[model samples]
Target: MPDERTKYAWRKAILAARAQVSVAQHAREAAALAVAAATVAQPGNVVCAYVPMRTEPGDLAMLDALVVGGATVMLPVTGAPGPLSWARYLGPDSLRPARFGLLEPTSQALPPSTVAEASAILVPALGVDRRGVRLGRGAGYYDRSLGAADPDTKLIAVVRDDEFVDELPEEPHDRRMTWALTPGDGLQQLHV
Candidate 1:
């Protein structure tokens, strides 16, 4: 396990990285990049994502792109520590401020189990490494939700380019990512 200071270092690195790119620009570019890769790698119609909060990556543009691409989009809703709900992302109007300063669907009930049905899932990360180890908001939310995904689901971490690195400390029960999407690289599979 990483020491407390090392964990903070990783988080600090990501914060520094994101500050280099405009959030609006990076979101639009990264979404287009990941969507293209996901289209080729995944065949399922449903894509699940989490709404952005604080300094985490946002997928507002990504969700719009998915809809335009004729794919169904699902947004994760925070539930009990280990479970999450997935609601259809109808559009901007469908979202309202929710817990954690995030946005969520106000009119859909696709159920939390919908996460298991996704062909692809885009998650926010404070940092992630080539080994696919992700450092989230220390909530263990994704670690739990990912355990429920189908084995081949495209579990991607969206981050600024520098936050996606060559290595990160690994641990058992740490779910690996299938890819990392960034403004510069688009969709890059973890190979470190």
Candidate 2:
């Protein structure tokens, strides 16, 4: 299990690095992420995806590509805030401001168990090791929500290229991702 200090150190370092990224660079990477996301999704699949916030990599572009590819996409809707509930991604127009500076779909909220329907879940991560250990934003929302997912569900962590690392401190409760999706490298499967 990861010690509290280790988790904090990694989060602080990655956030600092991410803050140095230029707006122009982030936009370019977001576009590339869209291309990679299109390839990861297949027609008629259900995908659970997150809308990037602040310096988080891969914005709605990835979710939009999943829609264009004929996949049913679900985005998180922050409510009382244990495990996140979900809502369908209708389009960019469907999003509205929500708590914690998040943009959520205006559609009806679905139960957290809704993630079990996903064939693939594109999660937001600060970093992920090649071993599939994902470092999130220190909130355990995804960690809680993902526990109900089907074992076959593909968990993909979306991060910047440099965020892919050799190892990360992990916990038994932490769900490991099956893949890491980066802007430059596209989608790379993780081997635990």
Candidate 3:
């Protein structure tokens, strides 16, 4: 296993690459990702997801697609950076700008434990390997919040096609993803 410093380097490199993505390419990937991600949103299912930030792989369209697909979408509400709280996503109109330049739902915030109700979680990742190791932005919010999810809940890491690699550094506390969702591959099951 690599140390935290290696993880830091990986995050920096991946983020730098993400920043260089062309605007046209980002739009194309976002459209494809929206279609691909919606496949996991079955009617009556509850999905825990996040609004992607600057240069993130997804956009609001992805969340809207999930809602249109009949899943009840819950978006993370940022606070003091432990486990994340959630709120139901009513629509694009329901969001208001919040901390970290994120758009959060204006609805009442639910406890962090509400993640346990999700059938699937669309987690943000800078990258994910075939073995399901996820490289996040080092906040540890998702890692801590995911602890409340049921063991059977599908943990899917959302990343761009090129960000899916063969290996990444992992720590004991890092939650392994069950699947990777990309614009090109859609949902590929990982070898957890």
Candidate 4:
């Protein structure tokens, strides 16, 4: 398990790197991410995904792709911040500005347990290692919310191509992802 200091250091460095992405490159990557994401969304399946804020990678395009691919999409609703609640994603127009510079669904808030209904979960990450450990923004929201997902659900870390690495620090409570979805690479199964 990684200590708090190590985790914090990694988070800082990773976020700094992500922040350096140019606006043009980011837009291209976001489009690629959307196309890649669509491939994983099965028809009639529920997909739990997040809307990208700032330079976090992937945009509403990713959510739209899932919808176009015939999957029902849900986005996280920020609440008190331990675990994220959920809301059905109607379309781009359904989003409203929320806390922490995020865009959340304007629909009814569903409990965190709603993740169990998803066949695939598109998790945002700063990085993901070869071993399947995901590095998030240090919020711990996904760690808590993902605990309620079905064990069979495909937990996928969504990142830029270079953000997928050989290793990342892991803690006991961290959830392991079985796949990584990157803009350039698309989806790849991980050996957790």
lDDT of 3 by residue, 119-158 (tens): 9999999999999999998899999999999999999999
Candidate 1: RMSD over Cα atoms?
Answer: 3.3
lDDT of 2 at 136: 87
* Overall local distance difference test of candidate 2: 0.91
**lDDT, candidate 3, at 16:** 81
Tell me the TM-score of model 2: 0.95
Candidate 1: residue 83 Cα off by (Å): 1.6
TM-score for all predictions? 0.83, 0.95, 0.96, 0.95
Single out the weakest 10-residue window by summed lDDT for candidate 2.
Answer: 1-10
- Residue 131 displacement in candidate 4 (angstroms): 0.9
lDDT by candidate, in order shown = 0.73, 0.91, 0.93, 0.91
The model with the greater TM-score, 1 or 2, is 2
What order do you get sorting by TM-score, best first? 3, 2, 4, 1
Cα RMSD for candidates in order:
3.3, 2.4, 2.2, 2.5
Candidate 4 stretches greater than 4 Å from native: 1-5
* Model 1: per-residue Cα lDDT over 73-154, one tens digit each: 8888776677677788899889988777878898666655688888888888887888888877677778887878998888
Q: Report the backbone clash tally of model 2.
A: 0
Give the runs in model 2 whose Cα sits over 4 Å from its true position.
1-5
Candidate 4 per-residue lDDT, tens place, 1-192, comes to: 233437677777778787889999999999999999999788999999999888898898999999999999999999887988999999999999999999999999998889999999999998899899999887899999999999999999999888798888899999999999998889999999
| Candidate 3 global lDDT | 0.93
What is the Å distance of residue 169 in model 1 from its true position?
1.8
Which of the two candidates, 1 or 4, achieves a greater lDDT against the reference?
A: 4
